[model samples]
Structure formats: structure tokens, C-alpha cells
Target: MLSFVVRRVVAAFGTLLLSSVLVFLAVQSLPGDVATQVLGKDATPTAVAALRDKLHLDQPAWERYLEWVKGALHGDFGTSLVNAKPVGGEVGQYLGNSALIAVVTVLFAVTGSLVLGIIAGLYRDRWPDHLISTVSLIGMSVPEFVVATVLVLLFSIAVPVLPAVVLYGPDASVGQLLPAVWLPAASLAIVMAAYIVRMARTSVIDVMAGEYVTTARLKGLSTWRVVTRHALPGALLPTLHVIALNVAWLVGGVAVVENVFNYPGIGKLMLSSVQNRDLPVIQAIALISAVVYVCCNLAADLGAMALNPKLRTRGGRTR
Candidate 1:
């Protein structure tokens, strides 16, 4: 198990390194001049040139990438081109905001999806199964933007219970941010829930039909005991990976939902950085996102190994 974890971590770092190259190149290719953005439209070519020179934008991309990588290895992500703030500090602050919303979305989405899926699976062809399956299908079909809009309408306009968009500043405390977090979280949850529910339902069905579960039922075990003791544990293994994938997906979803709701998060910051051609900040966010993605999958793999004893052995095939 330790060797397996070590190998996965090593591979994850390799993934991060490769992703950093892609992120840097992608952001570098985005059309916009940070110097021009900093100086404004009225700035002369000479002024822009001087600013670019001062910012070392005239250097070769390879030189810049090497320098950035060197600094990143030591926890220095460089400064934001637009604001001259440390990319690490800026990202740390807003990353928390984004994480809060994503965490809230995932918690509720996972809980509700598991319950609905399990119930649906147990009921099989019954009305409960049909209703949940239908809702999940609709959810899977709808886009995140559509879901966000409907949530805004239902929660913000029709009910006027929650704020339409976050009004708090970027530096607001978590307590201050909570009231505004719900709408976006709900929007993301509604969209993310479908995949998890579908996966969970399938896993449950498969587990229920497995030898042990069938034997347990034949032994005259109560339905609750059969499900909870014999089926749920097995069912959860596949669903765990599905949940991890959804969590990784939250990064992209948060990007969209944050913009729609005007929430101050790393996603909103990244978009703004792109518009302003703030390469350092953009690269930093992208790297952080890649890290999050890699870590999610790694953690999922470890968790699966821990849950299933077979996966702990040397010959166990990794899923």
C-alpha cells in the first residue's frame, strides 16, 4: 500500500509538470497584451514596450517558463502582471472561496445522490426508481448555465429569499460569504448530482445482484440488514470514484458558476486574468487546478485501495 501510494504521488507530480507546460503555453497564446491592459488604450507603443521590457515580457517563452518553474518549486508563483500581487497569496485567498462553494456543493450532492440512487436501486422498477431516474436524466441533459439561471429565478427572483449574486467583497469572511454561497452551490450541485446518482444506482444494482448479497437474502436476513451490511459497502466502491471525478469537475463548474453569480473566487480571478492577459496569475490558477484534479484522483485511488483489500496487494489491478 505504501509503495502504491508512493508510485501514485510520483506519477501525480509528473502529471503536474506536464500540465504546467500546457497551461503556460495556453495562457501565453491567449490574445491580449498585459502591458496594454496595465497602461490603458491611450498608452503609446513606446510606453507599452517599456512596460513590457520592465515586466520581462520581451524574454523568450522558454526562459520565462524555466524561471517560473524554478520559482514554483520553491513555492513562489511569481507576481500578477496586472496588480503586481504575489500570485500565491492572491490564489490562496480566492481559492478558499472557490473551495468553500465546491465543498458545499459536493457534500450535499453526494449525500442526496447516494440516498436517491440507493432508494431507486432498491425499488428497482417501482415508482420511486422511475422518479429518481427521470430527474437524474433531466439533470444530466441540462447545462450548468441553465441550471444556474433557473436557481437564480426560483431562489432569487420568485422567492427573493437568497441574494441573486454575491455582494460581499473578495476579502469577506466565511460568515459573510455564507448567505451568498447557496445559490451557486445549488446550481453546481444540481448539475453535478446527475452523474453521481447514475453511477451510484448502477453500482447498487450490481452489488445487490452479487453472490454475497443474494446469499444474505436467502439466509432470511432483513432487507435493511441485507442492504446496509451486505450490499452498501460493495456498492460504495465504484461510487467513490464517481464522487472523486465530480469533485475534480467542480473546478470547471465553479469557474462557470462563479462568473454567473459574480462570486469572488479563483475561477473569477482566472477569467479576469485571461481578459487582462495576466499570464502569471492565469498560469498559477491553472497549475493549482491541475494539482486539485490530480490530487482528487489520487485520493480516490488510495481510498479505494483502503476500502477493498484486494487492491492492497502487489498483483491487484488498479482501476
Candidate 2:
């Protein structure tokens, strides 16, 4: 178990380190020049050259990547070329807002998915399963922007209960932001719940079909006890990894949802930075997203190992 954990941790760290390289290369490959975007197209070549030189954009890609990595290791993501502000400071503020929404989204999604999934699995081929499967399908098929639009129309326009877009500044308190976060969180939750629900339902069915569950049932154990004790523990392992992926996605992949609702999250910020060619901010967001993905996956693996003794015994290898 210790060796397995050590290996996973080392792999996670290597994944993050490699992700930083990809992020740097990706940011460097974006169309349009950072200096050109900052100084405007009317700016002369000489002016752009000076700005590039000042920002070290004139340096070789390898040299710049090394410097950026060094600064990142020191918690300095460099200054934003467009805003002329510390990338870390600006990203930190937006990250807090994103985390708030992501937390709410996960709470809603995980709770709802677990309940609905279990019900659907237990009642497979029945009305409950049909209804849930239909809803899940719609959620999976519909895009986040479409979901956000429908939500805005239903709640904001038709009902007028929740705010359509976030009205507060980036520094808004949670209290001030709560009412506004619902629409965005719901949009994300709906999308995430789809994947989680399907995975959970499948896992539950598989677990229930296993021989151990049959043995427990044959022992005359109550259906509820058999499921709760023998089935649920194993069922959750697969769903957990799915949940982790969604959680990681919520960190930086909700650009459309955030944009539709004008939410001040990492996603929206990353998009804005992309448009303005703010490489520092873009790269920072990329690195953060990658870190979240790797960490979530690692946590999920650990959780699975905890839930399944066989995994630890096998040293996390599948036969």
C-alpha cells in the first residue's frame, strides 16, 4: 500500500511537471502577438519590439520556458503582459470565486447523482430508471451554454427569481455572490451530474451482479443491508473517479457557462486573457487546471484503494 501510494504521488508530480511544459508551449502557440495586443495594432514594429524585449518575449522559447518554470516553482507566475499585474495575485482572486462555484456544483451534483443513480440501478428497467436515464441523457447531450441559456430564460426571465448574470465585482463576498452563483452552479451541476449518474448507475449494477453480492443475498441478509454493506462500497469506486474528473473540469473548463452568466471565475478570466493575448494569465490558468486534474485523479485513486482492500493487496495493478 505504501509503495503504491508513493508511486502514485510520484506519477502525479511528474504529470504536473509535464503539464507545465505543455501549457507553456500551448500559450506560446496562440495566434496574435502579446505585444501587438497590448500596444494595439497601430503600434509600430519598433514599439512592439521594445515591449517584447522588455517582457523577454524576444528570448528563445526554451530559455523563456526555463525562466517561467523557475518562477512558477517560486509561486511567481510572472506579470500579466496586458494588465501589467502579478499573474499569481490576479489568478488567486479568480480562483477563489471558481472554487466557490465548483464546491456548490459538486455538492449538488454528487448528492443528486448518488441518489438518482442508486435509485435507477436498484429499479433498473422500471419507470424510475427510465425517467432518470432520460434526464441524464438530456444533460449529457445538451451543451453548457444551452443549459445556461435555458436556465437564464426560465429562472431569470420567466420566473425572475435568480439573477441572470453575476452583478458583483471580482472581490464580492460569498454572501453577495450566493444568490448569483446558483444559475452558474446549476448549469455546471446538470452537465456533471449526467456523467456521474451514468457511471454510478453502471457501477452499482455491476457490483450488484457480482458473486459476493449474490452470496450475501443467499445468506438471507436483508436487501438493504446486503446493498449497503456489500454493494455500495465497491460501486462508489468507479463513480469517484468520474466525480474527480468533473471536479477537475470545473476548475477551468466552464468558460461558456461562466461567460453566459458573467461569473468572475478562472474560466471566464482565462477566456478574457486568451482574447487579450495575456499569456501569463493564460499559462497560469492552464497550469492550475492541469494541477487540479492530476490531483483529483490521485485523490480518486487513493479513495478507491481505501475502499477496496484487494487493490492495496494487488499493489494497484489489475490482473
TM-score to native of every candidate shown: 0.93, 0.96
- Backbone clash count, each prediction separately: 0, 0
Error of 2 at 86 (Å): 0.7
lDDT of 2 by residue, 11-80 (tens): 9999998999899998888777878888997999999999989889878999999999999888899998
Candidate 1 residue-pair clash tally: 0
Q: Against the true structure, candidate 1 has what lDDT?
A: 0.88
| Tens digit of per-residue lDDT, candidate 1, span 143-183 | 89889999999988999999988888789899989999999
TM-score of 1: 0.93
Model 1 weakest 10-residue run by lDDT: 310-319
Error of 1 at 109 (Å): 0.6
TM-score of model 2 relative to the true fold?
0.96
Q: Which stretches of candidate 2 lie over 4 Å from their true place?
A: none
Model 1 stretches with alpha carbons more than 4 Å out? 31-42
